[model samples]
Structures are given as structure tokens and as C-alpha cells.
Target: MSDTAPTSVVDQVLAAVSELLPEIAASAAERDRTRSLPRYVLDLLSSAGAFSVTVPTTHGGPGGGAAVAFEVTRLLATADPNVAQIPQSHFVYLRLAELAGSASLLDELFGAVLTGERVANAQSERTGRTVTDQTTRMRLVDGATVVDGRKFYCTGSLTADWIAVLGRDEDDVEQVGFVRAGTSGLTIVDDWTGMGQRTTASGTITFEGVRVDPSHVVPRQRAVTGPHGYGAFAQGLHAAIDVGIARGALTEAAAFVRSSTRPWFEADVERAEQDPLLVQRFGELEVDVRAAESALVVAGAAVDAIASAPPSRVDDVAREASLQVAAAKVLGDRAALAVTSALFELGSTRSSDDGLNLHRHWRNARTHTLHDPVRWKLQHLGRWSVAGTPPPRGPQF
Candidate 1:
């Protein structure tokens, strides 16, 4: 039940990422401008075996943990948040498959991942009463399991090799079905118009009686009674994205001020970097970014601890992990928003040029942080602080 991939493969992927990131970063602006899928980067990572790193050591993968994936995600986010966020549900599916405890499901899904196949999420629907609510149905038509419904915010669906959909079966039990990318009656639309993460292609997906191989439909999200990290792990990865956005924005801001920005006229400085006010602001922003970064790593470690906690202490450890992740997410959200907005302010009018696309950072952060409301994150933190209550368990925590 490890999303903690084998350690060795994880290390190799991380090492390769060090070389790929500069290339990834160099193309981000253009990709943002065109709203192009960061297919180049996605292919690069897949080729480097990033997706395969999470395959269980028992499956012949170099063993590692979710902490490694978080680090890799943080690095990817620094270069391109859209690409960084896309594969979230892919790994989440791996977690789900593990929870199902089905040997066949694990081999099929993990083998696909190892073969560089990508799974896009088709889980959310606008018509649902709540985010977790699912109305999509998987029905037995004569013999085939057919899916029929509409999904919104189907992130990564466009570029994905496979689609993982959450639906309900005849007994009103929730289930997840996997469909190949080009399955009949499936329609993927490129209609997302959000101000940020545009390349994510998180738009409309229509499944009209699309057939899923019966073997590909796993019983969804098995209930785990013990202290577990089912939700904390997902939230921690989110924090990693925010960390990347904050750091990336700050990095770009520094470069802009040093080479492209003008000095404040009142300061009579030759360069913006020499202006004491701008320097002070940059230092403060760096401190915020680094603090958020630290929180992200701590959150990852806390979540990792859950994987090994003995049965007696697992509950408390899991609760602590959730709390730590909530803190990391709060810091990440604040840093991403504050620093991204500050990037433009410090860089002046020139920074707003369309060609530079510096604004995409703020736009991406604003759009993404809105996806999972930050208010709930604070509410959990406050509940834990004042009432000595553990955060309620779920993806929201």
C-alpha cells in the first residue's frame, strides 16, 4: 500500500529532473502564451521513467516513497505549474489501486505507468451537489460495462493516454473505471478558458456509453479504518505545487529586476537591484518562499511517517501528518499569491509585457488556489489549535 515508490528509481528520476528542469523552464513562457500543453516536458519526464518510479519494489521498481514524488513535483512546478499539476490524479489512482488491494488492478495500472502511459482524471462534475458527489454511472449493458456522463475540470484528459473516471454502480456504490484515451463515444474538449494553468486542458469531457473493460474497473476508494494518509498525501502534493509556484515567481522576479527593471526614480539608483526598498522586498519574499518550501518538505516527511507508523501510534501520527500538511498548504497558498503579485509590482510596467508572460505565474496561482478553497485549510488548522480536535479525515483535510 505504498505510494512511496522504490527509493532507487525515485533517486534516478530526481537526478534526471535536475538536468531537465532548465529546459522545461525555458519553454514555459512560450507554452503559457500559446496555451499549449506542456507535452514536451511531459514526454521528457515520462521518458526519464518519472511515472515508473512509484512502481512497487515487489514489482521490480527501485523502491521509494511519496516524499520523493513531492520533491520531484516541487521541482516541476517551479518550471511549469500546469505540467506539475497534471499527473496528480495519476498517482492518486495508484494510491486507489493499492487501497483496493487487488493484485490484478495493481499489475495492470502499475504496468501501464511503467510503460509511460499517463492517466488523466475525469472525476469531477459540475452537476454534483458537492465536490465528492458523483452521478456518473457504470452500468452493465447486456455484458459490457458502459460509462455515461459529463465531467468538468477533467485535467490532463487531453494529453493523457488513459482516463480514470469515478462513477457509481448499480448498488449505488462508488466505483472507478479506466478507459483508453480514444475509446468510442468519448469526447475531450479543449474549452478551458481559465486565466491560469491554461495548458492543463482542464475542460469538458463527455462519456457517452463508453465501454470499459470489466477488468479495468476497480472497486473505488476502499474505506480504511486505521490512521492512514489517504487524504494527507494528496493535499501534500498540492502544497508542493504551491511551493513551486512561489519559488518560480520569486526567481523570475529576481531575474527581471536585475536585468530588465528600472530603478525607482526617487532612489537615484542605477539599477532596480540597487534600490534598498526593492532589495528589502525581495529579501522578505525570499524568506516567505523558503519558509513555505520548508513547510512542504516537513509535510511530506510527516505523511511519509504514516507509511511506517506502528498500529498503536498510527492514529496520532496520521492526524499529525494531516495537520502538518494543512499548515504547509496554508503557507504555500499565501506565498504563491503574495509573491506572484509582488513579482509584477517589483518589476514595474515593463514586466507586464505580453511577450514576457510574467503574469501567468500569478494567474496560475490564483486559479489553482481557488480550486480547493484555502478557507477550509485555515478552518482545519484553527479547529486543531483551539479545540484540540483532529482535522476530519478526507481529501479536504
Candidate 2:
């Protein structure tokens, strides 16, 4: 879809998704109404090998790179934004396994991924004085690791098989530990009340002396500072989600204009599609979606390239990837908000329809894009343009 010839795995995955889209779309409204993702959809995705896309081929998986991930995310978001978003953190966990420097642990996690196990991220505590501050603690107890804290925005954990808890050790170093979902003393609260992306299940999780095996723990310092493509991978995934939302908005807008919308009485046009102003608006939205799509392709390719680069070139390649991804994120965020908001202007009263629930697009786009401030993204690009400075080492960069 982005002018690249997809590998066999990518092609097969896309074909499977195409076949499943009708069912996915048909249930999207109902799922949104309930503010929950259905198990059947996840089962279908597993059957299609969606979770195995990023697993290495040698690990008995597809090994689709970042570009394939972008395409898959875009397509899924077009069907259901919530469903599309469930894998964002899963991929991040997969990347973490690669960087964890524990071969046995990595192999175990990779095997779990191939077998359709989902990993949910438990980070972002509300009690923190600042975003970077963490009250979550990981400590040694009886020669075993234990994690204790309350985490909000624990996306996808409601149905996840494992939870990746981010915390700080006694030394104040950030660390991640994996725990089984039903582990004792661990509680996943379904209390997220966000106005958008309702089905993401981005709720709260409490870990009270939850045991974490030593092998399951990975220090996050290197992953945060090292020249891996994690940041770019994250940014690309978000950009693809926004792009998909914009595309979905545009698709719904065109359909409404063709069948349900009426032209302005004074315009002398028989149909809404025949109205020059409406046509101009559609054209503008199409251009925005196309621009966002192009940016995503560029950013995704940069991420894939940087991820495959040698260690000597990792820092430079990751820097370039960050710049590209920042640009793509800005464009995608803007396009999603613009397209979703503009959909209401195509006709009167349709925005108020309960059956359509069209407002979810804008809400989801607004909420998800706020994950990282776009102003900083622009500032990062500006600084790079003028000073040749790369983005700093951080997860959100």
C-alpha cells in the first residue's frame, strides 16, 4: 500500500486481515458501545498471525519488520482503533526482549509471542510528581525480585497474558519486569474512563509484592539510552494509527456524502458529491491522508533500516530515524484531527446520530495523539534543522 513490495509474510498477513475486515468493522460499533474489545477479534488476529509479525524468522515466526507493522496497524485502525492499538505495547515488549540481554528470557518471551500471548504495559502512575517520576519499586526479597506499585494507563492488560511493569529499583534505576497476568498479589483494574479510545482498556494495575523472577527483569537504562530503534518504532506505530484514523474518517465521509447527504439548497447541485465546496473539502482531506501516509512510509523504512544497521552506525541511524518519525507523527496527528473534525461539516445532523458514533474517531485521535506532546516534536525537528543536534535519549523522543 505504501509503494513497497511486501514480503511473503506481510502479504499473507494483509490478505488475512482483508478477509477479516468485514467482520471486524461490523462489530466495531457494538464494541465501542460496550467500551471493550471482544475476545473473538483477538482470536481472529491470532489466527492470522498478527502477533507473530515481528518475531524473528529463526524463532519460527513471520519476522516482518517495521514497515509491515506500519501497514498492519494502519489497516487494523481503519477497522477498529481500539483493536489496532492493543499491539503497540506488545511490540515494544518484543523490542525490550531483544534488548534485555538475557537469551533464555528472550527465547521464552518470543515463544510466548508466537503462540499468541499478549503483553500489556504497566507504566505511567498518576501519583508521580512528574511524568518521569516513578513510585513503583522493585526490590530483592529472599533472593527473589518483587514489584510493588500502582500503575495507571496499563493498556491492553485487561486481556493480556503477561504484564510488563516499569518501575525503579532501590538505586533509582528504571527497570521492567514481566509477570504472568493472573499472578498472586497483582490486580488489573478495569477503571479507565477516558472519553476516547475507550476499548483500549487503559486502566490501572496494582502490584503488591508481586514476585518477578530475576530472569524476567530487564534494566531499562540501556534501552532508553542505547541507539536502538525503539523510539522510532514507537513513533512509527503511533503515526500509523493516526493515519489509519484519518483514512477511516475520510472513508466514512465519502460514503455519507454519496448516499445520505443533501446539497445546499442554493447550490443547484443534485447531490452532495456534485457540490463544488464538498468536493474541495474531500480533495483536501484526501491530500492530508496521502501526505500522512507518505510520511509514515518514510519513517517506517527509516526505522527498519536503523534497526538492521550495525552497532557502529546505530546512533547515527537512530537519530535520522527519530527526525523522520517526528515529522511523520506531526503530519499524522494533524491529518487525523482535521479529517475527523471535518467529517461533520459534510452534512447537517449526521454528527448527532447515535448509530454512527462518528465522534469516536475524533475522540480516539485526540486522546491517542496526546500520548506525547506534538509541540516538542516540532521543537525537536526545528533544533535539528538549525543546529544538527539529535533527539535526546528517552522513550518518548
Candidate 3:
């Protein structure tokens, strides 16, 4: 695909996000210090239509597609990673709803999304030795579906209007059931103490016989496979987050070197920016960032194309999209880690200021990048390239 300027709804949304970066950056430190949700920032993003980036235009959303959503996510991550992460699952759930939900169900959820309501995911559980294994159960009880289980890494649940709980039905079929945020028997706990992305509210959520509407339950398999390329789209969002983190790190590095950093005594350069070694390091970092950005853009376009294609070709398109996204993920992970860690090298003492909290960038990158192992992503990509193998149909790829 040819690289062109972003236009239409994508351009509009990206412009809006760019305008909010200053304010988002201003509050980022405080939010990180307190590990509190940036509700004000989230409200601003919602008003700017950030949450509606991927919702269908027919459903009163911008309908900017996967590429547009990826751009928005990358911009948001640059300003505040915690806030950026809050909506990752929201997009995934919305895509799944569009792919598998019934007409009435889609209308209801999409309408809520357009009105600034958010959906949180309660999918990961500690009981499962493997990521795909689930102990959570959703069974029909007296004409109503009841969900009973505990969930960990339930990102964005604390502030969401609705929760999408992933579980297996009586027949062990994977399914997702939506429940209102404050429904009876539903509990959201802000207990996450991770080293990075602290404000994401990725904690434990408990559902003790929480009742779910029958219409709200959708088969996960249907959405995971279809013409939408939902898995690739989801992975693209993650890659965007990593790219944003890298960009943020590089931006900070440039500012500090030009203004506050001192040149090495032996080199005798007037400014840190003039130091040849530092300049070379910056050049190297910039190349890495640009390469990751290019990869993400291409992968995102592939996902968008697959999403818009006919269902007959979805399987083939999804495989290709998955391989592309896997490659992007690897690049994004390396770029973010390198840039964040390298920032400290410019001026270690000054960068260590308690208030600046520069280390948080590395912390966030290190923590969030561990969401999935990059080695496996590389393995999959290598397998695809050398052996003509396709990645398995799952969310992580």
C-alpha cells in the first residue's frame, strides 16, 4: 500500500488527539505518581470521539477503520500510556460486537459507545495455566445466564459503564457476556500494583452469580474468525501503544539534550545536542522509531483491508494480516525498550529527578511490552517467512 496523508474521519480524529497532548502530558506525572485513573483526560478523549474511532459509521460512529484507530491509539499513548491502554479492550469488544452480535444487541452497544459509555474486558484469569484455558463458567440458570468466576488483569473495569466477561458455557464453548458496571454480585477492585501502566486499573474483578442478558452473550469463535480480521486489529492496537511509548521517550530525550543536558567534559562540545556521539545515538534511535512506525502503518492498513474484504477471503486475509502485525509488534517492542532505556544515558543524574519520573517511561514500556512475549511473536513471524506457515487463529497474534 502507498503511504498517503491521513484524510476524512481519520485526519479529524488525529487532529483532535494532537490538540489534547499538552494537557494530557501535563497530568501524566501526577496520574502516574498517584496511580489514579485520568478521568478528566478520558472525558476529553471521549468528547473528541476517541472511543468511537472504530465503531461503524452506520451506528453513528466515525468509522475510521483499523488504521485510523491505530493512529489514534499511538498518539494517545505518547501523552499518557495508562489512559491509552484503557480503551484497547473497548475497541476489541466493539469489533467483536460488530462481527458476532445480533442486530438489536449491536445497536444497543454501539449506541452506548457513541454516547461515551465504555466497555471493560474481564477475560484473563489466574486459574488457567495456559492463556486460553478458562475456569470461569457461564451457565443457564432459570431462564437467565449467570456468570460465576474471578478475573485478573481486567483492564479498565474500574471506570467502565459495562463489563464484558469472558467465560465458557455449560458445553465449554467460549463466550462473552456483558453485564452492567454496578450490577448486583459484580465487584471491581483496583488492586493492580504493577511497575508500569499503573493507572490502567488492571485489577481483579469478581462475578458471583452475576446475571447476564441472553442477548448480551456472543460466541467468541464467531468473532475471532470472520471477515473483520479482529485478532490482527487487536494486535495492531498493542503495537501502536509500544510505538507511542517509543515516540514519547524520543521526544523527551531530544528536549532534555537540547536544554538541560551538559556535554561531556572530554568532547568539549558547547551543547549536548552538538556532541557527535549523542547526535549519532539520536540518529540511531530515530531510525528505529521510524521503522517501527512504518511497520505499524503497513500492518494497520493490511488489517483494515482485510476487515473490509468479503467473508469468503477473510481466512486468507487474516493470516496475512496476522503475519504483518506480528512483525510490527516485534519492531514496536524493540523500539520502545531501546528509546526508553537510552533516555537515561543522556543525563543520568538530571533524569533521575523525583518529580520528572523519567524512569516511568521505561517502567511503562517494560511492563506493558511484557503483555505478550516478543520471542513468540518473532518465532511466529520467522515460521511464516521461512516455512510458509500461518499463525494460529487467536487474539494475541
Candidate 4:
């Protein structure tokens, strides 16, 4: 583990992130087979300062902003999409801290983030009619906030030091309750058995009368107020992760073909790499990967743009960021699905051997991309393109 200082130059930040990829990629297949990521990888990432890119400079961080942070996510995803995604909510809550978290709350959470302590999210419910529907409820009991509800798809809940639970209060407003892991009545079950992203631990969390500090709960109003860029940033990160999976799949496809795959008999070629059709297919996958990467670049810059815009211009930047992030989502989904599928197709039958576990990329891409529907993303872009209608402001958009 490299010890990275808090004040980050973009290059140094990227370098630190780069250093971890080889080790991560080397062990990725095995970890996926076992369905567990080592906890120390988080520590190594923290020690490397990968999680602090979004931390403001005033707080002894580099404040590398959205673009750099997405870049980090993309690189990590190429190694292990599960590990890459584990902290997605950690970053989300960092932005939430900016919204409704009190200054003291900010200090505590940001401090934990800068040190690489993980914060998991407990937001989506298993039985909700829609993504935003909440069955979990929070109410006041003896001047203390008491939470009771079950959350599913609670990604990273088991791995986190703290859990941020989204719930509806008596007033019917969505709010987040921050609870320490293992708090009484808080149970994080390792029940995630998704075909892909199997190690994400995206399972069920039950908050049965969990007591939460009032100050630890972020008010929904403040979190939703102002020129919101969290949606764009979050979506952009999702795009980055998908693109990384594509890149990883493409890379492994080429390597597996070169090392192990025999050319089709009709091709009359000694090497699969020399097969004209395989080469063409690889080229096509590369194009898709490039397009997705380019889209993320554009969208990430738009996310960065939102930080410095004046209040009058905030709406414009915010819309642009959302539109571009939506574009990234579309392109990313296409590339990840295409490239990961092509991996086995290009490498031939031996690639499917369970021992290689090459299928993990496609599995991860399929499972993780389900976090949001790409069709809705396309609809938003289509609506924006045809009528100049901005996407509705919400977590999904």
C-alpha cells in the first residue's frame, strides 16, 4: 500500500490508483469465485487516497472533482467491477454530506472518507413500487429518532463502517439516517446471490427500531435543494464503471486469444489473432469501448462544470451535466454488454471454462447495469434532443 498525502495533484492521484490495478486484476477471478473481496483492499485504496479525490481541499484533500474521481472508478472497474462499485455510495454520501450534513457531520464523515473508511447505502427497498418508494419509516420516540424498516439491494452494507439508511419520516419526506455498523437492531445479512457482482454484498439490511442520532440524519430538503449535481455525478460514475468492465473484457479477450485460443479451422490461420474476422470483431468492440470512454469524458467534465457555476448559471450546467451523463449511460451500457459478450465469442470455447472465470465481466456488467434502466436514460436523451426538454431532476435522471 502506498501512503498518499492528502493534497493531491491529478497525476499523483491517478498514479496511485494505477498502482493498484495489477494486484487487483490478478486476484479478481478468484475473488469473484469466492464471492468476497478482501477488506484490506479497501485499506490499500484508502492508503492510496483513491476515495479522497472528491474531498474539498479546505479539508486537507486534493478535491480532484468529478472527472478525476470517475477516472479512478473506471480504472478500478477494469480490475474488479465489484471492488470498483463497492464505494459508489461512499461517494454519493459525500455529496449528501455537502447538502444536509451539519458542519460537524461533514467533518466526521469527510474525515472518515479521507482516511478511506467505507460508508454503505441502505436506500432501495425490495417491495417498492418504484425506486423512490420507501417502506422504511423514521419517527421520533422520546426525543430520539427511531428507524424501522427493511432495505434490499443495500450495496456495500456489510463492508461499510457506517450505513446510510434512506427512509420516509412522519411528514412523508425522504431522509437519510446514518448508523454505525452493528448498531442494535441493525442487521446486514450477506445474502446477495446475484449471478454477477456476486461479491458486492448487495443484500438485505433490516433496521428494526434502530436508534439514530438526530444530527446524524440528513434532512431531505437540504439534500434536494440547490443546483443538484449528485445525480449526474453518480450516473457518470456508473457509466465509468461499465466502460471499465468493457475495457477489461476486451483486454482479456485479446490476451486469451493470443495465448490459448486456436484459430477456427476454416480460417487456415495458425493464430486466432491472425484470423481476419476475429480481428474485425475486436476492432468493433474497441470502437464501442472508445465511444463509451469518450462519452464519460464529456459527461465527467460537465459534472466538474457544475462545481464553479454561479447560481444563475447553475441550472444550465446542471442540465448539461445530466444530459451528458445520460448519454454516457447509454453508450456505456452498449459497450459493456457488447464487449463482455464478445470476450467469450472472440476467445472461443475454452474461455468459458469455469476455471478461467472470464464470464465474470459479462455477469458483472449485466447485474450492475440493472441498477438503472438504460431505456429510461435513452428516453431522457431523446426527449432532451427532440424538444429541448431537460431531464427531470431526481436520483435516476
Candidate 5:
């Protein structure tokens, strides 16, 4: 697998990011403080068609696949992880439109993202703590779906133009749907102040008889899989964020060590780069980031192959993709946690800046990794390996 950015365009995209980093990083704490992505920067990225990567070529998009998305995410996240993640959900749903749904739906979905519209996920809940407890109920009323539930961790709800929501069917099966902005009964609680990923605006959204048209609902029979199953797009998104977070941590650590003027113990080391320990840790983190990127590329290839091949071949490809995606998530999450924790150790004493809010890397990794640990995913893979049985088919996440 050629590990370089696949095309000149991709290389161009990567290069353009450097000039934007200073401004992007400058806004990181403020976005976290405000609990939202800076509007103007998002507009810049959207106008550049960053969100168009996974859309099919016929749709007038980049058609760059997961590898491109992965690189773009890491590059952007090197400045602001929260901002990088904000658009990830858009890409995942775009993948859905490309492979399994209608072109009209694609236009309705990705079009909004391309036009600088934001999105959020109203999946996680507050009280009914089970992984599958989607207390946010929806019912059909007067040609519209009525929603009534509270969603915890509703990222970007305050600024979202649309939200991809999951709810239960009449027979208790699950269905994924969308709720447009300004829908009646949709309310956001301004209460997402947190320890990390604050720019995510991950507040709670409550739906009380919110009305959505039948067109907003993804068809029942069209359900392929939820976010956390074999070949699940959600795992790909998770892996992207994990890699981005780790890469961002390493970048911050490198900058901090190169310029910190503070003293350490009996010696005023002056420069963090001068420390042998820092060098060793940086080398280790570099290897980890490269490994995660490679794993993601392999997973992307596997997904594309499965998506392109016969149905009989799909299961095998999906299983391979799932294992690799889970492995990537686990490795990336661990790498981010390890890298950030080591930075703090290298810093010795916490300084005022402390290198771009280094603690947020650890916090973001913890929150994302804990969402559905890659270890549990590994256990599922193990069951498939040991029993000669494919992992269960259907959306569990």
C-alpha cells in the first residue's frame, strides 16, 4: 500500500493546512470555551470541499474514500480535534448515501454539509443507561414523525442544521432518521461545559413531539447496520478521531519541548527537545501514528472491496474490516493516552499554557474509547474467530 497521500490533490490539500494551523490552533481554547466550532473557519473548510471527500464521483465530490478522510481529519485535528470531529458524522452519512441509499437523499444530506451546514448525533441518552436504551421515542403523526426523548452527548446540537438520529420501530426494531433544524419540539440545553472536547458542544437535546416528515426517515427495509457492527461506518469514524487525537497530542508535545523555558529539578533543561526521554517518547509516538494510519488504510481497502464484490464475499470482507477497524481504534486510543500522559511527565510541573491544553487529548481519547471500547469489539472478533462464526449481523451501536 502506498502510504503517501494518493493524489496530487490530496497533497495539495495537506499542504494548504499548514497556513491555517496558527489561526485554527489560536481558536481552540475559545471554541472549547464557547462549545462550538468557529463559524468562519468551518466556512473556509466547507468552501474548500473538505466534507465532499466520501461522496461518489458522480455526485460531483472528491470520492477520496476513507484514507483521504483519515488524512484530512488528522491534519485538521493537529490544530483542533473538536473541529475535526464536528464534520466526521457528515462524512459517515455521506458514505451511507453513496452505498445504500437514494441519490436524492445524498443531495439532501451532503449538500447541507457542503454548504457549511453542521450536524450532530442524538443517539446517546441520559437515564436508561444501557447501550441500546434509546429512550428518545418517535411516532408518526399527521404525516410527520414526532420525537420525544432526551439525548446526552449531543455534539454540535446548538449549531447543527441537521441531526442523524436513531430510534425504535413499531415492532421494536431500530431505525435511523434525520431531524432538520428548527423542527418543533427540538430544544438544546446549554449545559455541555466539560473537561475536554468542549468545542464539540456536546449538550443534551430534548425532543417533545418534534415533527419530521416521512422523507426524513431512512426507510425501514433499507437498514444495513448500526454504527458498531461489521463494516460499520461508525467504527471508521471512531478510528479517525482516535488517530487525529493521537497525532494532535504528538504535535503539541513536540512544540512544547522545543520552546519551553521553564526549569526542571536542579537543571533548567531550557528546551524539551534537549531531553533524551522526550526524544524517545516522540519516536515511539511517531511509530504509533504511522501504524494507526496504515491500519485505517487497510480497513478502507477492505470496506471498498466488500462494497464492490458479490454478496457472498461481503461477509468475509466485512469481518476483516471490522477486526482492523477495532484494532486501529484500540491502538490509536492507547497511543493518544500514552503520548499525552508522557507529555505531562516531561513538563514536570504544569505551566500556564502547558502546550495547547494537552489534557484535552487524554480526555477526548477516554471519552471516545470508552464510547464502545475496541477491546469489547476485539472480544466479538475473538468469538467469530474461535467459533468459526461471523460476528452477529445488524447494528448494535
Candidate 6:
């Protein structure tokens, strides 16, 4: 947990998340096998107010900040990584609205989300190469924009009621838009079947002459640069997922070591936990987990400070917040990998029905970290710090 003032609402959120762990774990295998998120789980999350944390109180939302969101995500991830990640892409767009001070948009978008309407990201493409080159083009036609393009890795597409899409304008600058699900000329092609997070239902979304009203276009008058952007929020959430993976791995390993009796006893050892090396390994993983979590706290504080600042200080604050986000992601990602690997090795189970999904933790951690590897991102941050050059722009944050 981050060392900040704990709100009752945050505690309520944690309680809601904690209560879902059993259901999440129970459904993990089914979700992976089916390659789809169960509708019931999503309904449960909506009713719990999970998606309303970023929206303002005046708008009938929880009015929470990035840190509270991080905690909720981490808790959910401890049980099911796929389900935990499903809400992040939508919440990221909501956070963007908050940063932009687009309260009207937030009210409309979040009201729908609070009623179980899922949202997804239609940004990443097979050949969209950079943020500047949006392969998807939206052209003005009569009173609306006609969209034609293919978006890849559209997580939660199976359940989303709307998708926030990025397209190229006449000037080739990237702009964001929203299209309601089940709209004409829209198609969702199921394509995701990865080794991990298969339940995310991440696939390809196609828009062929999909008509979007002018009001649906997310304006880009202000260049989203400097600080106070998506990067800060993403780092905090990614770090939380990393830490959650570690915690899950450790918990599984600890339970296995404590109960599973083995026959490879040297003298009088009855279980793997009796081994000195296993004990030492557990301690090492615990230390790494704690360290990574602490780094996340520091990063969260940096993000909160920047988010609370006046509009004039946003750009510089965003840049500084970027560094902290990178640091947290790098450290937390490494710790998750380490702890999960150690847990697998410590567990001496040979059967697949050991009632422990050790490999899933590592697989989820490995796959999700690719969203933006902390190592490369850290180098970018260092480059900005040393060269005093503007950091490269990415699709999110």
C-alpha cells in the first residue's frame, strides 16, 4: 500500500476488490479456455463502483485519484490478471478526460460505464508505427466523420459498449474519437489468443465507413506533452500490476511450502519449506516485493502532486512525473518476474492439478510488461534528463 492518507472510499473500494478474489480465481481457467471475459464478472465490477473512481463527486462518481485507482487495480490483479487489465484501458481514457477538464464528456461517458458499459482502446495497429502516423483515417463527410481502419490489440472489445479510437486528420496529426459499439460498419474480429491474459479478449477492431458525429470527436487543440498526461497514470497502474503479480506468486508459494509434504527429505525434512534454501528464497522474494511496492508509493506521490497543481505548472510537472513513473515500472516489473520465477522453482508439484496456477503469474507479468518495457522507457527518461531533449511521444501518456 502507498503511504498516504487513506480515505473511507478507498477502503470501500479495496473491500469490494477483495471480495471478488475468489470469483476471479475460480473463473480464471474458464476465461482463459474460452478466451473471453465472463459477462457476470463485469456486471459485478460495475455494481461495485470500480469504474467510477476517476470521475468527480459532483458528477456522481467516487472522485478518487491515481493512487486509489492503483490500489484497486493491484488488489483485483492479485486474483485475475486478465480481469484486472480489462478496466485499465477504459479508466485511462476517463483519466484523460479529467486531465483535460472535459467534465461534460466525463459525465456522459462515465454514466454509461457505471451502468456496465465497457470501453476499450482502438489505438494500437499492426503498422501504425508511431503516434504521428495514425493508419486509421476519419474524413469529414456531410455532418459526421467516416472512419475506415483496423485497430489491433483492442482489449475488452468483446464487452465494450464504446471504444475510444485514435485516427489521422487531414494534416496527419493523431486525434481521438469515440464510436458506440454495435454501430453500423463496425466489426470486431476475435484475434487474441496469447499465452497469458487470454481472457482479456484483446482482438482486432475494424471500422469501415463507421459514422461518428462531430460531438463524438475528442478535440486535440492542446498538444498532450510535458506532464499531467497518460504516462503518469499508466506507470502507477503498471507498477501496481507488477507488485500484485509478486504478491500472488509469493502467496501461492508460501501456501505450498507450508502444507505440501514431500519425500526428498535429507534427514527429517517432510516438506519443501523445511529446506534452508527455500526459506532463504522466500525471504529474498519478500524483500524484493517490499522494495518494489515502496518505489511505487514514491511514484504515486509524485503523480498526485503533479495532478493537484495549477494548470500553469502542468507541463513541467508532467515531465518530472514521467521519470518517477518509469522508475516504478522498471523496478516493479523486475520484482514481479523474479518473485514468480522463484515461486515456481520452490514449488515441487509435478501435476497440473496442484490447485496452484504458478505459471499464470509469470506469464501475465511477462506479457503485460510488454505494454511498455520499463528498461527501454527508463533509458528514454534518462535521455531526457541528460540531453534536456523532449521525450518521444507515445500513444498513451
Q: Which of the numbered candidates is closest to the native, going by highest lDDT?
A: 3
Candidate 4 regions off by >4 Å? Answer: 1-10
User: Model 3: residues >4 Å from true position, as ranges?
Assistant: 1-7, 310-313
| TM-score per candidate, chains pooled | 0.94, 0.96, 0.96, 0.95, 0.85, 0.89
lDDT of 2 by residue, 1-397 (tens): 5998756976898789878877887788778887766668977897788877888887777888888888888888888888888888888877777776477777888898888888889988887688778999999999879999999988889989989999999898899998889999999888988888898867799999999888889998778787877777877888889999999878987887788888888879898899898898889889999999999999989988876788888889989888998999999999999988898887557655877888888888998889788899999999999998888867886
lDDT of 5: 0.67
Among all windows of 10 consecutive residues in model 2, the one with the lowest summed lDDT is: 346-355
Question: In model 2, which regions exceed 4 Å deviation?
Answer: 1-7, 310-312
Residue pairs with backbone atoms closer than 3 Å in model 1 (clashes): 4-65, 4-66, 5-64, 6-62, 6-63, 6-64, 7-63, 7-64
RMSD of each: 3.7, 2.8, 3.0, 3.0, 4.1, 3.7
lDDT agreement with native, every candidate = 0.84, 0.85, 0.88, 0.85, 0.67, 0.74
How well is each residue in 1-397 modelled by candidate 6, as lDDT tens digits?
8998766765686688788888877777566655656667877887787866666676677777777777777777777778878778877777665555355566788778667677788878777455345689988999898889998889888888888888887777666777888999989988786787777867799999999876667654343554554666866787788877778778877876677635356636666677777788788889988887887777777777876778888767766666777777887898888977777577765413434555777778888877776767767777887998655544343
Q: Write model 5 residue lDDT over 224-320, tens digit each, in one string.
A: 5532233455666667777877777777767666666354444446555766666676788799888887776776666556556567666667766
Put down candidate 4 lDDT per residue, 190-223, tens digits, no spaces. 8888899887757699999999988888876564
Q: Over all chains combined, what TM-score does candidate 1 have?
A: 0.94
Which stretches in model 6 have alpha-carbon errors above 4 Å?
A: 1-7, 34-36, 101-104, 130-132, 220-223, 261-264, 310-316, 349-357, 384-397
Per-structure clash totals for the candidates: 8, 0, 0, 0, 1, 3
lDDT score, candidate 4, position 88: 81
Residue 121 in model 5: lDDT: 74
What value does the lDDT take at residue 88 in candidate 2? 86
